[model samples]
Target chain A: MSQLNAAARAPLDSRAKMIEFHEVHKYYGDYHALRGISATIREGEFFSLLGPSGCGKTTLLRTIAGFEDISSGAVLIDGKDMSDVAPNKRPTNMVFQSYAIFPHLTVGENVGFGLRRDPRSKAEKAKAVEEALEMVGLKGYGARAAHALSGGQRQRVALARALILKPKVLLLDEPLSALDKKIREQMQVELIKLQREVGITFVLVTHDQEEALVMSDRIAVMFEGEIAQLADPETLYRRPNSRRVADFIGVMNFLPAQILGEAAGHVQLEVGGLGRFEVTEEQASARASGAEPVVGFRPETLTILYEGQQAHDREAPATIDEVVYYGDMTYYDVKLDGVDAPVRISMRNVFGRPVLDVGTRTRVAWSAGALVLFR
Target chain B: MKFSSLKGYAFLYLVFLYAPIVLLPVFAFNSGTIIAFPLKGFTLDWFRDLFANQTLGLALKNSLIIAVSTSILSTTLGVFAARASTRFKFPGKTGVMGLIMLPLVLPEIIIASSLLVVLLAVGMPLSLFTVILGHTLMATPYAIAVLNAAFSSLDRSLEEAAYDLGETKWSTFRLIILPLVTPGIISSALMSFTISLDEFIVAFSLAGKETTLPIYIFSQLRFPKQIPMIMALGTCLVVASIVLLATAEYFRRRGLAKTGAKDTGGFL
Candidate 1:
């Protein structure tokens, strides 16, 4: 576990860093948009900026595309400072959220718009447009009017248009937000495959956590114009460095805990519901929030031990306060003995397993390794 | 019975509004000079008289020149103002846009008098050029109103997308913004032309020797024999106005359809 922690913490040395933000700050008059953002995006990696709206995720993405000028710091693409670069001069293309398909042009003309300055012959440009259309699964759609396409098809056209230029970096600004849910899910998977095939560094800005987790190799979770945590999807989900990141990534149950003391490389803590337990240094997060210190655990970390089942770790007595029955799983709000508030637990409903009713007594099993202490 | 009376009221209101205008061409085509009740035999003599009048022809040429110049100048200025207001954020933007749009609601007499005063104070000679300047000032607010609708409805990402696809700012505006807003430009030009052509107060206040059609028609109203020719000219203007307004409305509707935007009510 310590080796995995060190491995995750160490600087990435294998792959080339394709983009870097060095203390980049952006201000819109009196409003500070991006605050000292510094990170390295690796080559050919699917990176995402995940945050709530107005958290500067889109601002950071625009800085790379040169659509927005940073007020203070430098944005380096391929290790070159891009302070004076114009958007058209930058080696980046963006798939805008609105798709921005030129309504006046046909699909072919829209895709070939970037090649106007190229010295290629007419037939070659036409063939290039055809190949780009086919790459985005929109074959034979070149002659169609751009405005006549459906929402998803317009998105595919936007992708083809941006990718036709073969830019070094592809920036996507909430590209799937305009699509319906079913299509959005499908396009998320397709975007990942497309990124792999193109081998260009992709920077995606999205507010949806599930989309970020599903499509990105690493995510920088931002809040209030600053990145709260930058890690892989697994680390971001399991060991979120801050309480806000833990709450943003997924569902986590936080219970107040009293920090007893710190010993040699370990911290002893007393949890409200599960009594005293010693947590390792890596399991603890040093966020000095003014509120009370708490211990957080994912819903799946706590389990309901049924009859004839033995716990792999410690067991606590609890009563099922509420039951929410999903098709494949059942969620229970279980209140442990002497704990005032109920903590949520998710149990899978395999065949022949009866769901426990509300107000029923049960034994809840949890492991100390899965707990994250917030101080 | 109440609903029937209300419908009758609406019918009577429309007839009251259109009755005088409908009579203009009726007398214009009448052979008899007296414009009273009884219908006279139809003749092409009054239309023939309008062509032989040299001063009226000169006035017509002057109005055309002033209208065309005003339309181009006002619409060009409208495009700049509308683009700036919609696509950017500057200090005191609302105040700047409000001042530019003030001519729409300002009384035409006040605008004419102030412009005449300013021009004479600056020692500028009053000619068709001064009248064109005055007409452009009067018509630009309307041009901006129509053009604001054009530019504000445009998705800003379209320009960014063009820039992202390796096009410079000038090419993006030329290829994308110019084509998309062509209908708005046409609509604004037509509106300004119509307004400038029929404008009497500014032309009267600004034009020293270059008499516009309206002023010439007003001066000729004193001669009873020239009344029929003036009515004939009014008939032509009425038809031309309807055609111009219809064409403008068509372009506006086509613009809405091309952009796939929801149709709010238009000028027509």
Candidate 2:
């Protein structure tokens, strides 16, 4: 965790660019698949392209692997032009979504397939294959038929096969989408650990927001063939640049607000139910949705006040409209005294505390610093 | 009791289909020259006569040559057509594939007559080569049908993965694709060989001088002395067909098992 944090905190200028897409655009006949995508993936960083399906995240990743040609602009890898290079000639490898292990080959043969052109001796290549299998926790599984392995095992074999080549960049296209929930989570952690151990630049494409947050050092959230926002996970979750981005990343409650004025470094706003408050300019996203101004805050940021509990920054009186009980937390849809619609508030279930029921009058604690003003 | 009538119908259907084949071996071993039901003492004279016939031997050679050439040519053409149809999209793709597969539905006599006219108009000599050409035209559509199933069932990502893992397109096809589809290729070749061996109309229409096995069998049907020898030959063909079909099914099942793919119906 410390190592991951340190990597995340490292300054952008400290690392060299591994992949650079300069205004890359791709068109499939009349349909625009990638629209002027321009981003640089730094060396050894665990980067992710995240969005819902058909957002062209996978298409952008394929441009790096030379599987798809861009309509215009350039994609450079390691400071060199890669437009003319074929997938086999490029210094990158991919773990396909289907985990395309060769059904006719054994596990070891599949892992060692890329070494056919290498100048190493047969015994040395065999040793390398064994080591690669062991690295993915599949020791002594080299001789087994690849088709007989389980889904998780096939994923491991694919990883070992790609990693054995020691390419400059590793591309993964929703590699965990096929596995069940439990195995998917386990593989996510294992992938992070593997990425850190190798220190190779890993570019992952996924639609799962939580998986991206838990695995990526920095994420590029895309929508409609365009990147909406690119930032660290914390920044993306806390300060999404647009309402659409905010809604896509996680649950954020939006309430109507009137922007009074801007003075000094703070913008004062009259929130419909929470009353007037001032927030810094950094808390306001500059891109407007052309809709009315609204104040957005996460569910966990609002806490339902208990008996004798003091409000930290500010307080609002509300009536519980609904209650959803989870083992670790309880979510309440509370209608503020003056607001027409209910906003969800999530509260941790502490020991010996009674579960609140619907229709109960309560006071909810909130802070102005936790809110984001979206124009 | 509800299914008793259905069971009897099925039994009758099977016997109707197989009873003639059973009669082939029964008459083959009977000593009587007449094909009537009264059985004489067992004798191998008809089998000896079948082996000693030189015209039959020549016809068998010609048929083998045609069948082997037809199988190789048709299967090679099938691979190209199947790969093209499955892995690409171009203008008139459906129409083009439909035209290529049109021979499967066209009557063999029509094909034979049209091909005979075309060959004569072009001043091409009719021989075993002509017979092979006609048989390949008739058999390629079936080959492609079998190969299309094999190629389409294959996941496209498998090829991409091989190419991504430092393999050129040709090498990937050779090392990854060829082995996976070997059973389909075998099935296709056997199908073409069987079609060519038993085909009569095209061979009769195109072969000006050379005679294939089917033409020989048809010619021998008029003579009473050669009837038992034809039965002996028929017995050999039946056994050969069973062995061939069983071998193909074995390979097909093995391929399916190797790939962990579900067995979706096969020749067996």
Candidate 3:
């Protein structure tokens, strides 16, 4: 996983910008849909706009496809201003959330829809359509009726139809949202592989944070018509800039903290359950959300030490409040001796270790380096 | 042997509706010129006389022209109205659509009289053209009603997909929207044609000398000798209507099959 992250991040500085949004604002009557969205998508990068519903992520994506016009500011595609370009004239294609397969046409006709104006011969276009279908793993399924396919097959056809154009950018609006859990997960991996294979700039809009993290090279987390944070997946997961972003991304346990001192790019903090510790300024977010300062950590970062185990970092004495077990991992909600509320700790279930019961006494091993202080 | 009250009511209602139509064919083929039948022998005389009548032929031609023109004009207007109402939002949209669909409930006599007054005030001479104008005004609301269902059920993204695939707005409508809504268009056109063909108040109020089929039929009702021939004409009209409706239903089912859409109980 770390190797894949390194490879995805290695060529960031040398890539050209494929899409640029410069202070774009969109309004529908009285409601502001996108508030001054400014971002640059690198060439061949798999980017994602992730947010909850009504967060303007889909609206931002439609701007790139020219399906929507901004109320002010500009959008540039491949270094050219796209103010006057129609959707058909723009160098982009979109896979709509509905899949938008033409029910009246066969899969082959739907895949070759964009080639109607191409100067290529009929035979060449047919070959291109077949090749596009094969790329989406629907090689000999061209003659099938579009409306007769299942949900997953329809999505594959939609992907083939959009990719056949070979546009500079491909926009997907919640493409896998309608599939079942198993199919959705399968498509996520397939989409990542397909993006790498095509090497096109893919801008995906999804409400699923896990989907975004798994597929995107970089993600822009949006909330209420504005981007809250934009960074790569690892940075987004490890170092969220705000409490809202942290809460939205994944499970994070918060413990009340007090600031003691700051010097030399390090900050001293007194935490509620884990007692006193210091964190680097990079680990602390300076943005204040008008709440009490809290130090947060992921559930996996806190390990419940078993009998005869040694602690590598600081140790906290706690009592198990609740126990929930999966086949592969066990979660323990433990209350530290000094804290009122229990914080969750996740431990991987090894082959020989037995799962602990509720109300058992335990010691939690944690490190200050894995904690993020949010104010 | 145990019939429900509701079933009996339905059976009686159907008989009440169809018995008059059944009698038209029965009397049309009867040999006697008298309306009352007591085992009258079958004959082709009334049908032969119906074909030889020149005045009836002229009225039929006039009605055909008026109905054809009204159907085309009203359906074209309905397409624009339905598309605009379903796809786009503008100021006072509800009020605009309400006004367009208002004529569906308004009495035809009121529309015919008001249209006659306006056309005469403008010194537009009354003819089959005037009748067609009045019939189109009456039929457009029904056409819009049928077409609104078609346009509203279409996915908006389908048009966007076509546009994104490099087709212009016109081509997208021609290739995608038009073909998809064709069943609705045919339904609307047939409805308009039937309305204009059978309309009496508007044709009587607007047509100065040009007599349509309904006006001629009404005029012939006074002469007792022409009653049998009128029954023959009514029989032919009923047969034509049945054939037209069956053809329309066939096309509608074929369209649904081609697109794999569910059959939601279309017009029979």
Candidate 4:
């Protein structure tokens, strides 16, 4: 399906969209961990809090979980004030980063553990446990001890335990972090599948941008203690609203950008070092961005030449600084003098031919449409 | 496994500490009631006489009640202390923790006398109630020590996960936290019980009309003929101490094993 069609048909189900934090501040006695966080989480949507470590992403998640109360401002969940709601009383469940499976309990016990007073009949509880285990692909493993499971197995167990409770929303705090790379990829796919099947709101906190992009329906890019941008992963990656968001999500070449002209349709930007680039509203509304913009172009969109003079308007002459071969594509870190940072261009081997070498002077070329100018 | 020779050091360690406890039952059966090396005919007279002595039995009953009360109360306090110290960041946290642990280093005599003076000044009479209060205060730090091991080493993410799973703070602690830290709680309770049982200075100073076993043993030291009976009682106490200490150690070791922590340093 086309991106437009998918977005046009996107449904915001009864996702606990009831989360709101109004001017909330958290202080660890002078060290302001969360300066002033104001955010609303829509229920049923898979929203990911993405940032580097110590960006207060986990703190945000904990605050939502009621583990850490906001020092100031009121937080509401499901339209009820959550300033005094304890973690246990909240209608949310979390899959922790370490996959905090109860070490002393077996898989079955861990899954049904939260349902202490859940008046589910024995058969119903067993059925739920079995279905949850099966959903995570650990059907028969319910009898296995939590300690005996491998990291991935343990992660699945943690997921099943939380999922079985079927809370209004599920909070995943880097739940797949403990698994090996291969298993992490596999589990990421499984997690996305499970999130869809369960149809519960999921708020995932992760420092890993790749993982966030891979799993989240919408991503909230956090910096320090505030959300820099909240948009779909593609929007977040393609045209990050801020220079900080652009630098965070993926590799981008930032050149000093100025508005040459702004009309009702498109905005003309004079990007220093890389020359002029035009951005249209059909790409992403520039008004939501800024007036004076910082022009950025994704590395993968740029084509690096071995040796050539570009005759096109969207060409930047630069010397190939570094070359990184990543199996499917080769990344050329091109350095154009007078630019603030090195211009990165990733070229895939379409016809089994290699591109520019390191230290080799080359011209990087891309479409005027490919370059994104953000204010 | 390569530290096989460390087993020898362990053996020596046990013998050095418990050789006396091993001799208690041996001397308990001595017909002479005297604990000398020369072979004495085996007799159950000391134990029979101990049962027959109404005051001694009363002392035994009093000590049991005090220790049990101290264990239950101190361990309860320890649960809160352990949870607070592990889970939250409070003001003056370190200083407060140091103060709690101060009793561990302070001499028992000082604690006893100071407590005695304070209680008297407040018009509280010396009795089993006062003894329980003092013993609980003294045993609390050890309870904290044991429970802290369990609480600190616990997987905190588990608790976070519980909260995310729609569990209230109280429910999570009741259903999940307590179960995970059960071994530590048990170990703490046992350690407190034995510490109170074997404690003397505070109990002696506080026992007005009520004498605990340790105070009774101390009083019997005044008479010459009572020496043998003291040994018999000493023998019994040695056995009790070893049992209590061993059980506490067992639970502690089990708690550590549950958390997958290395046995770096432990109670002998």
Candidate 5:
């Protein structure tokens, strides 16, 4: 971790500093669209810019692709500055959210368009185009006009068009945002495989938390034009450094906690209003220097136990308000005394068992290690 | 839908507008020299006479020269103006665009007469050059209107993707934008030609020594003996105009269809 920390400070020390945005600011006349955005994407990494809408993820992608210019700072490609380079001149291509498939051209022509300028023979271009189509699993779709294809087919064409160029970096602006739920799920799996097959830097911009979590090597959660947190999916979800990052990742329940005592790597916290409790060590060390902080825990960390189980350590006697079956997992909306709202809890479903009905009095227990404290 | 009296009146109005020009060819083919109510047997004599008239022939040449030049020039300027207006923004763009499109609503007589005064003050002679200038100015707005629609309907991302793929702005336009809008350009060229060919008032005001086919035909109307020949000339011109106009309309419709738009809105 210390070596990793030193390496991160020296960006040039890594061979994988594929695209780096430095002090990037963008303005559209009056509106400050992006303010001082800085992030680095490593080579062969499937990185996601995860944020709410209007958080400037798409703008950042566009800027990297050269469709948009940054008002201040530089966008470096592989280490060189790309301040005035146009979109066509960049070593990046984008699979636009709309898929942006040319309606007038056939799928082959659309994919072959970028390769037309290549120093390859006509046969070579044709072979490349064919290979691109095959990669997208749309073999023989070359002759079909873009508009004639289905939504998924269009997406494939879009992917093929961007990927055929063998651009150093491929930007996906919410690529899965347009598809239906089932198709989106399928595409995500296909995208993961495709990313591995290509082994190119893939910078995807999306607002969907689960999409980012499942698909990214690193996820940057943005809020109001700045990165709230940048980490691997697990670390981003479980060890978020800020309250905003915790709230944005998953269904997290936060409660105000006061630190009774503090040390270098430990702190004591009084969390529950009705029943006082103290949590220490790693969780406490994750909080800010002061005592005024918030305690956050994901739903999966909480477990609802039966009434027969005596009130033991790490058990919160919370009554179930509602139960929602999520196929693989069951989500319970629990209302504990002294808590502001119904705290959510998720439990893996066991097959061939009596279900936990709603309005049941049950005690829920979560491992103290799973809880994260934030300022 | 049931037809009504107003529909009957509208149908009559359409016939009234077109009947004389339509009948011109019928009478030109008539064997008799006198154009009267009586039906005469068909002959090709007047058509031959129409081709033989040396002065009329010269006028036809001059009109063709002026119209073709004007069409080419108009379409070129129209392409630039339309592309700029539709695809970009600088400053005072709307005002400049409104000014370019203003001639569509302004009366042609007023425009022609105004050009006469402006050209005379500028020391330009009333000739084919003057006629070409006036026709080009009048026809350009129409060209812009047609091409503007063609350009704006274009998917902007196509060009951006081209740029993203490493093509410069100029190359992107030359390779991508030009191909997409070529149909509109072809239609605009044809439409401008037809309008210039059919134009008379502007030619009359600006073409002093060098009279066009329309002014020549109008001047010949006073001579009683040339009536049959003029009728023949009119018949030929009417036919040619119909063919040109139809060709222009066909290209325009084809252009619109190419861009996936159903409406064939055009200047002519």
Candidate 6:
């Protein structure tokens, strides 16, 4: 939870900036890969470009690594324009999605490859390579053939190889997508600790939203070569500026609502099945494109109040339609007495709490503060 | 084992393929000059005669020069062609590569005659150098085919990774690309060498006054007494070809194993 709080903190403008994209536009023939992107990543921040495939997340990361040339606009690294910099001369390294370990070299040789141009003595360079390997938890693995390592070991080798150079920024392109679920989760925590220890700006490109939420200090959610929403993990999930951003980051239940009236910072809406409620300006976000007005609530925000239990803010009678049992939680789809469709509600399965059966009558408790009006 | 007819057909097919090759060594050691089924007493007289013949010696020298030059020239050109075809997109790519590989399926005599006509029309003298040029044009396709497999299987990210780690484009190629595809280069060179050494139509048509081994062997066929000597030369060629091709195949497999790529059947 503390880690989550750290990830949810915003980077202030007072901090030094590491990378800045000024109206970056990239075109591959007729296809526009990145369209007029302008954003600044602060120094020592764990930033993420989160999106689905073909959303230009990886393409944006490549621009930072100098692997891709922007058709128009400038890319500035530490206040220096990089329009003419070749990838080799740029002060950045990337961990490829495939963990591109050189098959012909030993692990030690691969990690020391970037040191070929370093003016340091051979002994000093070797020591630095060993230190890098030890940092990645692959100590004493230098003599092993690179191709013979397991997939997780190969990923560590890739990390060590890139970090030994101590570049100004480290770019990771889906580095953990190739690992199994358990290892993927473990690596996510390890990567955060490593970033903190190294104090280098990390730019990660990932399609997994939860991974972004768990690791990034600030996340830029992209769609169709445009940033749909850029905010901290908490703000992006709780106060998404558009309906599309809400749907992409997490699950949200939506019901048809009629806009009763609107004021400067308050919106009065009569929501279907759940009755009427007044939402503030911060809660009434605009809908992307022209869609019907609706009020949305997260599954966990609506609780099934047991018999004789008092409502927290508002109460509605409903019958259980379906129940899904997870190990630590239970999800129930309940149809309110006047509602036409069933709405889902998740509850923590505490010890001795009854798991309600289908068709059971129950009272749902909800609050106006949890509602988001998408109009 | 139950399909007796199929088994017999396979046996017949093998004999049809290797029967002529088996006769080369048989006649090479025979002392008889006349072509007959019964073998004469064993003797190395024809082999001795083959060593002493001045014209055969000259033909051997010309063949070596042509084979070495053709292999080097074609493989170098093939490396460039293969790298371009795999790594970049250009207009008319397929058309250009198709034209380069056209000679592989084209009849050898047609290519030889057309090349001779064009060279003479341009007032270029035909010599061992002309033979070398003809052989190189024909052998380039095989070299490209082998090298293309090598380059296409290589991961593009490997080069990018090297560049990201501060190596220049040329050093990236020399350090990573070259070593990864070395086996392929070796295989391509051997293939070009083998093809140019045994080629007959191009050498026969384009060679002027300088006889390659194949041309010399054809001219000797008119004398009945020289048949055994020619058989000795054929036996030697077969052995050399087998050794060369086997080496090429070994290197090809080593390349696949090193890259951890699957073996799609090759020239062997």
The TM-scores of chain A alone, one per candidate, are: 0.95, 0.97, 0.97, 0.86, 0.90, 0.96
Which parts of model 3 are misplaced by more than 4 Å? A1-10, A286-288
> Candidate 4, residues B119-198: lDDT per residue as tens digits?
99999988999999999989999999999988897788777776666666677787678877877788788889989998
Of 3 and 4, the candidate ranking higher by lDDT: 3
Candidate ranking (lDDT, best to worst): 2, 3, 6, 1, 5, 4
The DockQ scores of all candidates, in the order shown, are: 0.70, 0.83, 0.85, 0.49, 0.42, 0.71
Kindly list the per-residue Cα lDDT of model 2 for residues A187-300, writing each as its tens digit.
Answer: 988998899888889999999998889898889999999999999899999999998889899899999889999999999999977999999999986455767898899999
Best by DockQ: 3
The CAPRI class of candidate 3 is high
Chain B TM-scores, listed for every candidate in order, come to 0.93, 0.97, 0.98, 0.86, 0.87, 0.93
Evaluate model 4: give its TM-score.
0.83
Q: What is the lDDT of residue B156 in candidate 3?
A: 94
Task: List model 3 lDDT by residue over A103-167, tens digit each.
Answer: 99999999999999999999999999999999999999989989999999999999999999999
lDDT, candidate 6, B1-268, per-residue tens: 4879889999999999999999999999998997678998899998999999999999999999999999999999999999999999999999999999999999999999999999999999999999999999999999999999889988899999999999999999999999988877887898899899889999999998889998999899999989999999889889988887887788778766765667777768
TM-score for candidate 3, please give it.
0.97
Looking at model 1 chain A, report the run of 10 residues with the lowest lDDT sum. Answer: A1-10
Q: How large is the interface RMSD of candidate 5?
A: 2.1
What part of the reference interface contacts, as a 0 to 1 fraction, does candidate 4 reproduce? 0.75
Between candidates 2 and 6, which one is better according to TM-score? 2
lDDT of 4: 0.79
Better of 2 and 5 by TM-score: 2
Worst 10-residue stretch by lDDT in candidate 5 chain B?
Answer: B258-267
Error of 4 at B91 (Å): 4.8
- Judged by lDDT relative to the true structure, which candidate is superior, 1 or 2? 2
Fill in the DockQ of model 6: 0.71
Q: Please list the residue runs of candidate 5 whose C-alpha ends up more than 4 Å from where it truly belongs after superposition.
A: A1-15, A84-86, A256-267, A270-274, A280-294, A306-313, A323-331, A347-349, A353-358, B1-38, B222-238, B245-268
